[model samples]
Target chain A: MEEIKEIMKSHTLGNPVRLGIMIYLFPRRRAPFSHIQKALDLTPGNLDSHIKVLEKHGFVRTYKVIADRPRTMVEITDYGMEETRKFLSHLKTVIDAIHF
Target chain B: MEEIKEIMKSHTLGNPVRLGIMIYLFPRRRAPFSHIQKALDLTPGNLDSHIKVLEKHGFVRTYKVIADRPRTMVEITDYGMEETRKFLSHLKTVIDAIHF
Candidate 1:
């Protein structure tokens, strides 16, 4: 239980915005910043902050494409995917344990 | 989609810790503040801030018991519970739609 608590508290993917990002990245493995912004209904500034948190924690890798629009792309690294998996699992355990 | 985004952004239960609190409160409808803190493994300071945010949003109602220990009790209002349900549902919709 203590270990679970630590994992829950320390997880970097601690917000709905970020959770949405990880889940969104799961199947596609990667996506453009604009697509994620549109899908999650997040403002560009808001999404940027959340993505930076994930990137800092090594949950997501970010890069830019020199396209006509010069788009930015985001992808969940292996570590990030594992972290998301663990965060979800820990959350479920905590919720179940606290069931009335 | 824009409306969904607005609801997601304006929602007060925006963190993992708060989400855990709502899930714990769902079955029991109410619990002591200490219990919520322990169950979610949050500090008194941390839990207090989260609870206050919920209360401010009319999602939770909080009161103090003048017992020997003076425990604070927290309850999820009907509105709060419904809001939690919507948050969960909206999150799922975003995830499904953003599937790569």
Candidate 2:
């Protein structure tokens, strides 16, 4: 939890688009690329880039469906789940501490 | 907390320097500029810029000491505290979700 908090301390989550993606994927065991794109209102390129970053950091896993049409599915791993919880908790702590 | 989470989702806080400043200020009622700098290993210029960003968001409060050696004091606001907590929580959530 401390590690996750440390990582998230530098950047505050302001991009609703990304938060939408994370929240959607966070609860689900797995989801397809198209599903995420539609839910996030993001272009293929934009979502692709976001997923790539998450993947690069080992926060998400991508499984390619090699059927008639290639489909990519994403899943949040344990590490990712921990990060999500930590992120949310930290925000709550900070909010609770707010002066106003 | 939700608002803070939304804001922090876009950028992951990876800058240790910024995190240090935040943690230091988070628990303290007020701290001087030099105190934060020495504790954070940040130069005046770097710390000043960081403080400016936090100040812009109303996360921190600054006061000048007119006794003698021209000192500046900063305190974290309630809003900032809430933001800090939210940020930490979200990161934890993300980490917990990771597979590995």
Clashes of 1: 0
Q: Identify the runs in model 2 with alpha carbons over 4 angstroms from their true place.
A: A1-20, A66-68, A96-100, B1-31, B35-46, B55-63, B74-100
Candidate 2 chain A TM-score vs. reference chain A: 0.77
The digit string of per-residue lDDT tens for model 1 on A1-100 reads 5534544475576665677678778778899999999888778999999899999989999999987889999999999877776665655555445423
Q: B11-77, model 2: which lDDT tens digit per residue?
A: 3232444555676777675899998877666689988987887788777889899777899998988
> What is model 1's interface RMSD?
5.0
| lDDT accuracy of residue B61 in candidate 1 | 98
Q: DockQ for candidate 1, please give it.
A: 0.29
TM-score of chain A of each: 0.82, 0.77
DockQ (C-alpha) of model 2? 0.16
Q: CA shift at B54, candidate 1, in angstroms?
A: 1.1
- Which ten-residue region of model 2 chain A has the weakest summed lDDT? A7-16
